[model samples]
Target: MWIADQWKDYEVIDTSDGEKLERWGDYMLVRPDPQVIWNTAKKHRGWKKPNAHYHRSNKGGGEWEFFDLPDIWQVHYKTLTFRLQPFQFKHTGLFPEQAVNWDWVCGRIQKANRPVKVLNLFAYTGGATLAAASAGAAVTHVDASKGMVGWAKENAAVSGLTEAPIRWLVDDCVKFVERE
Candidate 1:
């Protein structure tokens, strides 16, 4: 039961009725969760006045109803910063839940006491890439979407790792690995 409790910019304020209310930095958002089967009372005030709400449709997909949201935002975890946006499929560009993994990856890299090279596949928005780079590891970040690769680069720059050893690649992971 790993919890990403180290986050100061993100938190799950409450969960009820197949939905979880989350606070991403200064904004609150209501998004559906399949695992929240309990129909508990939504006691949190954030549920009433969220910055945005993602309504899941029974037919297939869903849409976001925005109140006071922006096209882009930023969140921080330790020394790293991530650019976030509410995009397709109810996804924020950054996954706050993955902070535990980022912490572990940073710890392992720092403990190595030598130069470490990491290959991050499907590295969306460069969370792990930035963590590894911050820990002094040379990272190769690859993703199929050129836009996502570009987004990862933005995250890297925002985290002040513009001079860090990171190689950004936009290609299919399998083909990239096969060629390397």
Candidate 2:
């Protein structure tokens, strides 16, 4: 198992009882985790006063119980910026763990010396596409949701990449790939 130890703005405050208490750039949130089965007491003080809690349902989905969370906000991973909001799905428009891959791909693109054209399939919210664009690659970002495609455009704009050669497409990734 590869472990990362370089994140300065995120932390896992505690994990127990099938839940993870995390701190994301000043906001503490508690969310469910199927990997954690031990019912240990949360030692972190943030766990007692998380800004939001995601409660799971027996029927298959879940809901968020917010405390002092804002309706929307922004965060950064190095040079890339992202909008964060508590949505019906347990997502905040950004996946920080993928920063490692972003850095790797960006480095490869920067060193390639040739014009790089990237096709991003299943490009939810365009994180990978934005990363490639930031690294000076022309990218075609494809997703099924128009809203997600719009959000990705906004993220690109926030990262000062609106003029980057990125083609945003609202289409099913599998179907698009098959057609291509």
Model 1: how far residue 73 lies from native, Å: 1.1
Which residue pairs overlap in candidate 1's backbone? none
Candidate 2: tens digits of C-alpha lDDT, residues 1-180: 434345676667789999998877779889888999899978788778899999999997899999999987777777877777878767777767776777778999999999999998878877799889999999999999999899899999888999999999999988998899
| Per-model TM against the reference | 0.97, 0.93
List candidate 2 stretches off by more than 4 Å.
1-6
Per-model lDDT: 0.92, 0.84
Q: Who wins the TM-score comparison?
A: 1
Tens-digit per-residue lDDT, 28-140, candidate 1:
99999989999878888999999999998888689999999988999899999889999788899988888899989999998998899999999988999999999999999
Candidate 1 residue 122 C-alpha distance from true site, Å:
0.7
Backbone clash total, candidate 2: 0
